[model samples]
Target: MPAVQEVEVVVAHRERATLRVGDMFLKIDADPERADVEVQAMAIAPVPTPEVIWRKPHVLALAALPGRALGRLGEPSAASSTAWAAAGAAVRTLHDAPLPPWPGRSLEELAARLDGECEWLVTNGVLPVDLVTRNRHVAEAALRPWKPVFTHGDLQITHVFVDGDEVTGVLDWSEACRGDGLFDLATLTLGHEEHLGDVVAGYGADVDLDVIRAWWSLRSLLAIRWLVQHGFDPSSPGCEVDVLRARM
Candidate 1:
């Protein structure tokens, strides 16, 4: 008998759907199903959060991501632009959704968390001297007075799943926080300006795009700083991150 492997299936970016391997067959790139809320929301106007179909001891809930990431879709054009627009719309819906106050930590707190971790690594001699860079300052500066809407701290094309020109899913909610929405938007916009423009155009509101860019730049530096501290040689596979830093 093939021993069953217990695995939390990575059905989306930064999220896993826990399931018994023996019960359901699985495969990569399989659009298992539009998460329950997704299907209902598509039918109705506002989508409720997905309900937990199964629960293990102490485990709360689980959901899967459907469709493909915008980045994985090659070549930017009208089609890609439309896809970006749909993705933006989906994000807007999530942003507009009224959820209970995430009364835990703020962006500054999270940035500080990153700093604490980095500092610890540096102090422990596990990080390089340049690990603490000017980036942390930038991130700290970016955290300012604003309406703290829900923020998906790690916003990117990979975290967004699209079907054709429609956004079927917004994957990853672990970094969800009550903070500046632009921070999330900026994280999405950091490298891809064209796509970012498409997103903004789709947003079509009085949103401050500059704030998003600033946040993006700050997060970019933070990412680079963390990477450097982890000791990836900039001249090796690390050159790409350095390139991104240069762009920032």
Candidate 2:
């Protein structure tokens, strides 16, 4: 026990905590033994390509930055143009970074799991396969010729930070993977069109927009399957249906 300190939890599904070391800052995650020491080692490793920057579990000694996330950056008006640009470029930088081998099951494996969920639900007559099949196909195809690269598995407005067209840092890498840059781009652009516009303009990167859209469409359907399986208020309407329907 290296003198236990205060544990501050962050928003998101996984358990993450920030510890106070007398006058120092240390981040800790749940581990059975020598967690602090291990995190310290990870922190010293070259920050895993920018995309996984958010996903790694490490204790860094860097100052936090200013500005809010893209979602909270306030509606896309005059005031947010710079923030918008920065968010997009930051994500681009992340996707451009070379990646190390990711440690989870491949995207295809995950998508197959989603299909299993869909099959189980439809078999039980919970939801129509027609409701999810179109999107599921999109998801499968996106993973089919997967080109592994640094990717922010979850690229949402809320996960990005900004400071006048410059990303001081990107947060939340727990879902990071070495996957298609197009996949990451599609994930961010799917729901938030405004953000997508800004990102395209800011990054000025060549991405197969169609491929991104396909994956985006598929992810939505997968989400619906998860919601239904987890008992998350079935009556609750979600954008998955709209995205899936439009594609079909």
Candidate 3:
């Protein structure tokens, strides 16, 4: 066997750290319960996901997927429209799978959280009050009830990997639970709106574009505070702040 390689930090913060070693990724999470949920979610997801290598008290190791990420948060995607469509199909498969035993955030919980985040944004003057108020109204549409589906609660573009026009794998299942299907779609295309048509077409279902747009505002508004506190620049082009600005 080859000698174990040196590990490189992929991402790190107080909450969690991910390290890459040769063909494997070791995720050291602050919350072991989240790690357990990630492991179980990966086991039951219908779409292709990283192969689990092993698990310990606070660490979970997985084999790297075959392809590169579909896109980064603040960068243009080089992936073709077909690859975006393939990601949509993969999400459809995940949603069609039996609901996970765990529950996701309720509409009330999401609203309460969004309210608090909005208040924080105003209090800190992170963004103009008018912009926050406008987007808050837009976000209200997404608060309505819907039939629950198995959702990859955090389907950020970078988590979906693709090779050519095929979706090779998806990553990060800690937030996986029964939730609104549109939330997954919206999260996947958050800042990458140009690809929405392709993703919707591949989903093979008619979706409410209004609700999707609402989620864009809702997600962006809720994320800015966390992104800022975590040392991420939400004002970068194609990032959460930019997404909010586009709505104005």
Candidate 4:
């Protein structure tokens, strides 16, 4: 008799779903284009990524990464500083690679989206007006023009995996595009501010700390609504709400 593989739903929402069955992941996206982007981005990214086993119209299968995730949003990372630094170095390599063919959200697009999301947040009473206003002001600092690079647009900590001091793999490439490098930096350190130095040390570049901070606020503010609709809790300790509160 063969051992039964347990099916685990890694994430699920209206748009997409990821399932883990033993050592393989099955990604089901509403849009096949997103899966196409994921495949292409993984192929071109300099960093390690999950191996693509196969793909259908809306479903893609991939081999699971070997190591645990870097960390979760609402939890402290037990991963070593060396592991964090290794993730940063791998990110730097990805950023230095040739720009992907697709473009990321432009400054105007992001600013407009920020405005709309903020309005919705206030009108729906999802967050305090004062809190929304304060973070909106901070978010302005991240709206400035910048040279584009190959960026993993959603570089969440959970998406990066590490084994000891080495970054074993990075996941989720549908959002990859040419965008600000610091946005990736900010996203990686979003809920885990204490490890910023370790990441910067490995990035080995002079970055504007203020800009990264601005991005932290901006990304959090922009994410809250989507997170809520997607059944995620942003107000948990060490999560998005805390990241915004830390700025205040």
Task: Give the number of the best model, judged by lDDT.
Answer: 4
lDDT of 1 at 239: 36
Give the better candidate number (1 or 4) by TM-score: 4
Q: Candidates' lDDT values, in order?
A: 0.53, 0.56, 0.93, 0.93
* Tens digit of per-residue lDDT, candidate 1, span 154-237: 666666767788876554444565666677666665556667777877666567765665565456544544545555343343
Kindly report which residue pairs in candidate 2 clash with one another. 54-173, 55-173, 55-174
Of 1 and 3, the candidate ranking higher by lDDT: 3
TM-scores vs. true structure, each candidate: 0.62, 0.66, 0.97, 0.98
- The sequence of per-residue lDDT tens digits that candidate 4 reaches over residues 75-132 is 9999999999998899899989999988888998999999999999999999889889
lDDT of 2 by residue, 1-248 (tens): 67666644333223445543343334445542334333332343233212212324444332343554555212333326666766667666666665645443476687677777667757877556776676666666676666676666667665565555555555545466566777666665555555567667777777666677777766765666565554443333324555566576
Cα RMSD (angstroms) for every candidate in the order listed = 7.4, 6.5, 1.4, 0.7
Candidate ranking (lDDT, best to worst): 4, 3, 2, 1
Top model by TM-score, which number? 4
Q: How accurate is candidate 1 locally (lDDT)?
A: 0.53
Kindly indicate the candidate among 3 and 4 with the higher TM-score: 4
CA error at residue 229 for candidate 1, angstroms: 9.4
